[model samples]
Target: MIKKPVKIQLSEGLDARPIALLVQEASQYSSSVYIEVDQKQVNAKSIMGMMSLTLLPGEEITVVANGTDEKEAAAGIERFLVNVKNR
Candidate 1:
């Protein structure tokens, strides 16, 4: 398992479109990916779960992945969350 803290850099924060894209990004990995904030954790691949997070710009979140591709999954999620261009 790997866990990395990432600060959301998206100017619009995580709305419907971004959350959908994020779910798509997470679905590409074979590992299980989750995002944690304020002691709440949700599957990164689930649009509904991610939407429940109500993530906002500047909010720090932990990307967690556990599986054969755990490292790659965690890094990918972190990159997506931290890069404004990805939003």
Candidate 2:
């Protein structure tokens, strides 16, 4: 398992589109990926699960992945969360 902290840089936090995009990005990995915040963790591949968090811009989150591809998965998610621009 690998855990890395990432701060959401989206100006408006993660809305429907962003969540969908994130979910899509996460689904590509074989690893089990999750985002943790405020003691709550949600499956990274589920849109509904991510929505439940109500994460806000600048909120720090932990990206956790456990599986054969854990490191790649975590790094990919961290890059997406921190560097991707809103479209």
Candidate 3:
């Protein structure tokens, strides 16, 4: 398992579209991926779960992944959150 804290750099925050895209990004990995904030954790691949987070720009979140592709999953999520323009 790997856990890494990342700051959201998205200018528009995690609105519906971004959340959907994020869910899609997470779904590509074989690892189990989750996003944690304020002691709340949700499956990164679930659009409803991610929407419940209500994450905003500048809010720090923890990306957790546990599986054969854990490292790649975590790094991909971190990159997605940090580099908004590419997403």
lDDT of each: 0.87, 0.91, 0.90
Model 2 over residues 1-87: C-alpha lDDT tens digits?
999999999887888888888999999999999999988999999999998888788999999999999999999999889876744
Give the lDDT ranking, best first.
2, 3, 1
Each model's TM-score, in the order given? 0.93, 0.94, 0.94
Write candidate 1's Cα lDDT for 1-87 as tens digits: 898989988777888887888999999999999999988999999989998988887888889899999998998888777774634
Model 1: ten consecutive residues of lowest lDDT: 78-87
Error of 3 at 20 (Å): 0.7
lDDT: worst 10-residue window of model 3? 78-87
Checking candidate 2 for backbone clashes, the offending pairs are: none
Per-candidate total of colliding backbone pairs? 0, 0, 0
The residue pairs that clash in candidate 1, if any, are: none
Superior candidate under TM-score, 1 versus 3: 3
**For candidate 2, which ten residues in a row score worst on lDDT?**
78-87
Tens-place lDDT digits, model 3, residues 1-87: 999999999777888887888898899999999999998999999999999988887889999999999999999898888875575
